[model samples]
Target: MPGPAARDAQASGSPLIDTHGRVHRDLRISLTDRCSLRCTYCMPEQGNEWLARTSILGLDEIERVARVAAASGITTFRLTGGEPLLRTDIVEVVRRLAAVSGPDGPVQIAMTTNGIRLREVLPQLIDAGLSRLNISLDTLRRDRFRDLTRRDRLDEVLDGIAAARDCGLRPLKINAVAMRGVNDDEIVDLVEFAIAHDAQMRFIEQMPLDAGHTWDRSRMVTRDEILAALSARFTLTPVPGRGGAPAEKWALEGGPHTVGVIASVTAPFCGDCDRLRLTADGQLRNCLFSTTEYDLLPILRAGEGDDAIDAMLRSCVHGKLPGHAINDPAFLQPARGMNAIGG
Candidate 1:
């Protein structure tokens, strides 16, 4: 049964629509900011500050916000983190969220993990109604993987991926960040690996979300270069019907398997974006590159009702910019890096 907030939303309409006419439906909730690996592209090896345990949203608090969001017409929720599996109560988190239903029905619960601990917790997550998965895999080589992630757990990630596939996670997505002189040479190899594993391969353009703030446009691999490199190795027919999905996909060899490229930099898809982010500490972000945040934790902790929560969310969406102005000259990277921002 729909709660009051949800019933109100249905009675009227989703209050999540922005000035651009984009109805926000996807919510990326950061479970925690403490990660297991210090991926070079994501964060530094040391001196990284973790959010205070108390400041982080509690289980009930998270459920309250999610319930309000579900009522606001958030149909999909992706659990992300420094590494969500690190949370001791991750399964319980999933279970609680799985129970929240939106106007469309029970909200689709997905997760984006580093895959280091996926094998151990996947069964529990699946049982908790996790509907989809996206695992980060930059390179197939062990040495490169270690160098990229600064971790010697490449084997563990691979094992987890295998376990996920074996468990029948169809169209399993493997996300790889393409960097010049980093994993660019292995583009074809990664696709082949994904095909062998029966998983979809997605190459992402390294955005300006690194902790170091040293992202050089020249060093970052552009979408064209990635497509060109792949085109030389295999036949790629463009897959149509790309709506709001960040990835632009192509049918590989005209068959079931496909490859995707999230060209966030060169080819921005901000106009069709339907995502909102909730940081681990309970701040609401309208866009991934949004400079401003609407803090919801304080209100949640103050015993505010769902109406207040829903109003804050509606205001956040109402103030959303037409697009992330990365191409604009005055663009400034958000103070929080991707790790802290719930990417």
Candidate 2:
């Protein structure tokens, strides 16, 4: 991947594409295209026909992509998956990516996990140099949680979060995809839960990412709506972490820690977008809403080196849509499983 200077060059004097835009800085990588849960919003009633286990990216491939990304001025990244933890050698991948060095230095490594297998991997992952964990916990109610996630592991996830907290993982972020009349009622409760435990909570607005995600504007519990509910109990204070990333961060009124809202649907942050994504099999997606991907696997498997992958990354970033047309009534994300796309 082109370094920051080179990307800047691509965006300006030597435009990477038709326009002078060099945004897509955060690259979320999918280590595995499989998840343990079938959340109604993320999967079909009939589960996804996942890719064969052997087809997923190997550790070396993952390192190569990270090396390219790190080389290209890209420094911030997160590991996502059907469930990143489900991958057998996730710690090794984390170690390898964290090991990649840039002119400025190594990139930051983080992961979005389901938190089910977290207890088994927290210490090892911390040892591997992962700095952040975004655990998906939509509901605090056990029965409701089982109904939402379509599984029975709320206790396991909670335990995982507790274990992660104990392991000294600073800024451990808990992600809850708010659904109206479903999990929306739990917003304040969830925030309080996080406050009591001193963990950061983030309520994500359901994006129209996939039909399987069951994307519905009606279900979209907006940022204002969530914040309003929380404001009733605790005095809410805003934290200025918003820019390109999805979440708009805020600290609780009287609490010691903070919380966030990933208002992707209701409030799109496309203009400030600084993120890209790499699927496990080596397809690079520029915009989450647009399904077009530039294949890096063939280029990599063909024995092309970093330069080729870097160019591919540049092309992907260059080709990225300035902003998704999700708000348009005609907007429709392509039919691809979220797991396959590194959700």
Candidate 3:
């Protein structure tokens, strides 16, 4: 039987439905395909090509697409990037998206950032209607952080986390990518750090989204391995009703603090996924691993109205595969890395 949330979603008359009967309500918008750090798991340390400034969508173009999405029943807009905080006009972006209204109400605004520049812009962002935050921090050790991201900005990230907490961003999520020989040893320690900061710690299993296409399955950490490492330190009580959210959450020791794992590889959750991604260059992606993308910039620039965008969105969702198919024998990594695709 469908739960109340599912039943309600079905009754909402949303057009963002796939052939598999999934109703899409979440949209991940990538502001830019540029980042300050080059995480080994995400991009190459050098020789990475970025989109031309003219090819990237402008603020007005982004808002128009978002407005169409909101009218089509998308309720939440998560702003991402190579690093969203890197965008100079991010606060204005939030202000614009927050003003967009859906059937339910004004759209919910959220962001996923590296946290290096968070402290400088968080106050302005909050004032501009930013509601939720997720900061990426892989390792607690400074030297390891430098090696993992090829940047010595761990202290800046930590300060950003503290600033976010002080600003009252409850359930402030700290995202860490789990790797086999790299930061896997810090899984339990990362969770403990989240507890100390009153934040929810989420560990994401590294996917084959690297710009260099050098991802090795043997070197990737699995969800079971992450859970096993945590179990040795604290009691984890599974939190039920994950719905469409990516992370599988667990309450630590049956209390307030909790930890989550986004097992994209080991335990795929494509059946209930409601996310639709809009790349910084105005490409619409059905799945993170999708090789196919529908370019929206030309249409928008060509003076096509909302009807055109709405049709494109429906067309994209209609073609959504049953799952990401990462486990398939024929699975191929996306041509663009996570930075370009939007994390």
Candidate 4:
């Protein structure tokens, strides 16, 4: 049950509104907490226990939740995971989500993947109505890739990126986490790689989501530093029209495409946050760093109707914090890692 504050907000007729007046419009759904690669930044080398099969939401339940959310104004849906592609029924999930329509039209469906298993499945996914992609490729060197993800699959990932382009996954975006000692030196090289593939690039500052809780600020390459590195090599200017987007955009002076930076640590964009997360285990989280979660699975499993589920979700959103307290002195790291929290 929600607290008194949430109840009061619901009385105002918009349960999704936080006290700060932010409206939720984007929903990130984690299909599974299972991944093919064990990225050092995401999970431990040995890894944590995986969720039980019975705990995860069924495809039908997922579609029902998505439909309710779409009707309530969540226009964008991003499928995440420990590795969403690891789910055997991922194509079927995409197909169901693609059919959910709002007043405007079909909901926009996107995915964030590691790209290891993407080469063979890219065509099926694209044909199943996946609209966009954000591939996580931290390094181009095979050895470095193996070290980062504990997997020697850089060749496969590169192949996947190329396949994504050939299949018309237009405006593809490559996401790279900028860590000081690890892959920071290759920022420019990554930019070049994106250019060659006709894909956009976004360099992100590493956050405190590692399973081992070993994240160090000193190792995090800030946005300013990334821009400085890029600027030293090429002319750069800001691109306009970034509303509530996590990434700040900049166009390369000589190129037609642009690059971006998601500086969550240095530049918090909580004021413009319009997104929420649904864990693979069927918990609704208002913020990525939230300590409390609203369980929707029990209601789903009990065969509650759409109205009952909708009201519960609304109450959950009303309890959202104004911002993730990343900069606060009393900030607390979430108990779950990025993998469990839906990335």
Give the number of the best model, judged by lDDT.
3
User: What lDDT score goes with residue 12 in model 3?
Assistant: 26
Query: Which pairs, if any, clash in model 4?
Result: none
Error of 3 at 32 (Å): 0.6
C-alpha root-mean-square deviation, each candidate: 3.7, 3.3, 3.8, 2.7
Q: Please, what is the TM-score per model?
A: 0.96, 0.92, 0.96, 0.95
lDDT of each: 0.90, 0.79, 0.91, 0.88
Report model 2's TM-score to 2 decimal places: 0.92
Consecutive 10-residue window with the lowest summed lDDT within model 4: 9-18
- Compute the lDDT for candidate 3: 0.91
Question: Which has the better TM-score: candidate 3, or candidate 4?
Answer: 3
Go through the candidates in order and give the clash count of each: 0, 7, 0, 0
In TM-score terms, candidate 4 sits at: 0.95
Per residue, candidate 3 scores C-alpha lDDT tens digits across 9-38 of: 333235588879898999999999999999
How does residue 164 of candidate 4 score in lDDT? Answer: 84
Q: List the residue pairs that clash in candidate 1.
A: none
Model 4: how far residue 229 lies from native, Å: 0.5
- Provide the lowest-lDDT 10-residue window in model 1: 6-15
Greater lDDT among 2 and 3 belongs to 3
